[model samples]
Target: METITTFGPLTPAAEIAAAFPSSVQGKNIIVTGVSPNSLGLATADAFACQSPANLIVTGRSYDKVEASITSLRSKYPNIQYHALIMDLASQSSVRDAAAKINQDDKIPTIDILVNNAGVMAIPALTLSEDGIETTFATNHLGHFLFTNLILPKIIKAAQRSSTPTRIINVTSFGHQFSPVRFSDINFSKRAADLPTAERPDLEKTEFFTGSSHAEDTYYGFFSYAQSKTANILFSVALNQRLWAQYGIASFAVHPGAVGTNINRHATPSEIEQALKRAAELGFDAASKTPEQGANSSVLAAVDPGLSLVDVAADEVTGVYIADCRVDDANVARFATNGHLAEKLWSLSEGLVQQKFE
Candidate 1:
């Protein structure tokens, strides 16, 4: 594996694949939330061009998954593509998808798993079929269960391969908006009423909770932020538990701001307001093309420069990648808290009624 000296925020995914072709060649990669114009599709397309053994794409809709795979097959005819219908909000759906992958004869091992599917800023407080908050369930818990269920395959791939098997959680810079509200994860309690310790940043609380803190004041972005924070924590705990023992490296990636349908739940006015808040936090909030947005994830998945050995040796809090490089300054302190990561891992296990060792 070769290393690149520099990669900018606007670096193209193709350039990453070209830089480390061996990292992707003959590897089995799975990317969730892939549709025609989604960031997941862009990531998959990058891997496809590099001659991966299998490019498995997943989404909630069969039509969308089929369309994405069809388009990719047309352009990269030599590559193999598999479509799995997975509704990340539903635990049952995630289980079925993972089971299929494990039972499928063609998918012997999973070299890369990109937990890229997610919903953002859902305007209302919706619940999944399992009765958990929709945003949290879809963005964090769903991927949690799915990844754990598929651990066998990922570990198997790592055992046979020289390069580490990678798991990329597509998180966001929006994680700065809020930490995981452990006490009020579902936001059943008012953010203002939570203990001061629970609400670490009062200003951020006011931003997401609003001044009123009314009972019905459900801030969609707050829930989205909490889930994104969970994504990073999950990666932290995952890497800690699996890196040295199983040769698996996990990364949380902020794929810049890409124009995609993840915001379909938000109205134009809401989007405008969110942008204003983002600017206040000193974030660029500039939009990138799907291809460019996929760069960070592509880099996290294949860049030989990243070392799980170093992460394990240092016992670093967590690894958060942005703009195709390790950029921890942008991550919220709570997102990288090792204790929080362990707590989240336990909570996730209890919620899913299963444990991954």
Candidate 2:
């Protein structure tokens, strides 16, 4: 049994970014889901202190966007900040935001794109405006569409720059709960959860794939896990394309157990139940502070260790990061399947009705 390991008391993102001043100085970076207190804000805030030429923060509401920008501006007056209105559940909103970002004259290039905004299990079956499952749409499809649309600016930044630009996807270990479901990727087909005792196959294989893992009784936990798996696979696919074409890099990180408002949509009963389950799994007491949890994301974004000449030799792009370090095989086997990643990419392009690759 792989015992659940308690990730450490990590160095805060501010401390980590201070060590690598050259990496972020005078660069353009964008972080999504930058509410008052979030992993995304912490990541962007750390870089802001380093005097980035442009730091963009985005959220679903204009009020949250302005509030975050206001708060960060108070702390780092020297940093140039921009706010964008984005709603990950709507493909049209994502496209509009991307178009606005691309046309901004002040933000000519994109040095880093941190896909850090995500929603947790809402404990219900809700669909986005595009008819896709809400959890899957916000967590995976939105970032997929956003990245493809903004990749040109990223490529431009990398081509005429001294360092490689990055696309960072903040995923989670819940990805181990399931794999990409090819037959019922959207949860439109067979949807139901089987009791653990009844599903003997689940006992044999620690991780199960496909619609078999979805909720028949509306088990939102599994739904969130499946969406997270999509995040990892997308990072794998995007990493391949970025490296081959633009000499850029993409990475995914399991930003260790953090206390945040991602569970805002969960009902009180659902929240209590989740806490109880986390306690049973030894995950509750092991949680890191929001700032500490943001360390892995900051590390993935700008760590001198990742810029070594030997980094590419190790194929660091497709790997997953945890505890502020990259681990070769911490992710499930399916996450590394190139063919499957490509298939998911194709499915994602179809969902958004746009093809940028």
Candidate 3:
């Protein structure tokens, strides 16, 4: 199927990886959330094939990180692979990981940072030790803190190289399902499960988060949507800031529907309903393999075309990309909300209890 952006039928990850031997070769890249059989793993795999100078695979478990390193070493025995343990679920873990990475003399700079780690559709309303909601903390706040901490390294790398630095935040097209729950993001009163009649107007039915899922139920879908929205807004705001101040390029990518660990949380009945809906939509395949799924992100990471945006007026360009091309953000107002982005940025700083400034 052709993408809405009109540029591709979706290039597979291998072809995309092989296409940019020059750009990716010898570049120091960090890919987060790379466990076995996952999106980040596939992405890191493709990147390793491109002969990166160093590939940093970061995840929650030391065993997982070691497993990824061992797996990648079998394929690219020569390229350097470093394992860094950083759990996105814990603020202290994130802080400790960042501090270690910064102090490491060997990892002096990073050319590309792919924020692909995320927690999705968690069935329960879990929170981090810092008391922030689970999905929001893992999907948004963890990346938020990690990025700010490593941003100096990315900047250092950009300063030395003539090329622009890149930060790719992997978001989801499902962002339309919900926006930031400004008043009660922590679910103090079960914001997602509030009485339908009393629920906020935006959640009731907006281009994003509005659905036929019943007016009085919580599906945990909207929680994921809200976090994805945070990803999009964060990209826009980050690009705008970094471009204005440092000239680095940042992007948000929707790595099409791909089969991965995220589906594990769904109940059998829920999965059945999803498959039924996908079948109803003209028998379209609801999911793709990790290679196919990693296209947009790999493209975002190496595509020379994305560099053109930085040349336009200011670094104020952050577009939602999918299937290897720039696509609409589905018109979710919050994606373009600078005020809300700034507010979320500030709120995130407090939640993680850290300030980049």
Candidate 4:
């Protein structure tokens, strides 16, 4: 398929900012995870300049949400701003937030939704209140619900006004590890039997001690990889559903490693230092500033030429993108093994059947 050679890794956000069409002048856009202190804030800032009809920013914490809104308002005094508190780990919160956004009086339609929030490697396994794994809960399931909930409003608005609605799932390249384990998602039974650190002395040591699952056996990196891969698979599946019917195109993006605070989930210092060293060497594992990381997400959300892709297309959808461009290798793998993607989608759906169905 034909591709844009201009899009490249380490592509500056300013380049993306330059590509945004002037047509978004009065459009309604909602960006999740845009707390004042996060990379989402940079994304909101970039989009804020385009003067959308309404800009709604969200975060898991109320304080961060308010702070982000306050900062944006001061920076862009004339731009429309709205802020909401949401924790993606909780299904009820996702449902409530979507409902509230759909019902807002000023916002007659929803144009673009960006799912940019994510968590990294957590040493210990934990579950959300809804009883799903924390990593899977926050990274994939929450955004899935948010998109579906607001889809109708977005589609209706798009239909009435001829405005295209876009859903961008922010993903990562680290999703190359173990595919989804459909059988055991929550690790409920496993978590229950695991010995806590408080138990100092170990009497019978036939296997792993602190964590029931050995680090080598069930690497934290593998769990993270599974979640990120789910993000991509969800986007591909979602794109097929929405693009054919509603003309609402969905895309997944792996914002090349950026030096951000997405690593707040009990990651080891050794891993942290490794990331730092890799960043210095200009590897795919590196992190850019918050602004740089937010660029691709904004592009996927607002760029008008998204739906145009061919099978031979380089850097295309239903594939993984890194450094602001698509990876050819991932595309080929996905095209061949669609079952993996299908299985992940089904497994995720099963886990959250209560909230979504």
Better of 2 and 3 by TM-score: 3
Q: Give the root-mean-square deviation of each candidate in angstroms.
A: 2.6, 5.3, 4.1, 6.7
Candidate 4 per-residue lDDT, tens place, 270-307, comes to: 45654655455556565577777877776776666554
The segments of candidate 2 whose C-alpha lies over 4 angstroms from its true place after superposition are 1-9, 189-217, 266-285, 307-318
Per-residue lDDT tens digits for candidate 1, residues 240-332, read: 888878878899999987889898987776666666777787877778999999998998888767855234333354388888778766788
Predicted model with the maximum TM-score:
1
By the lDDT metric, which is better: model 2 or model 4? 2
Cα displacement (angstroms), candidate 4, residue 231, comes to 0.3
Ranking by TM-score: 1, 3, 2, 4
Candidate 4 segments exceeding 4 Å error:
1-8, 161-163, 188-218, 266-269, 272-286, 307-318, 330-337, 354-357
Which is the winner by lDDT between candidate 1 and candidate 4? Answer: 1
- Model 3, range 21-41, lDDT digits (tens) per residue? 665888899999998989999
Per-prediction backbone clash count = 0, 2, 3, 8
Q: What is the Cα-based lDDT of residue 277 in candidate 1? A: 71
Roughly what TM-score does model 2 have, to 2 decimal places?
0.85
Report lDDT (Cα) of residue 303, candidate 3: 67
**Ranked candidates, highest lDDT first:** 1, 3, 2, 4
Quality of model 4 by C-alpha lDDT? 0.67
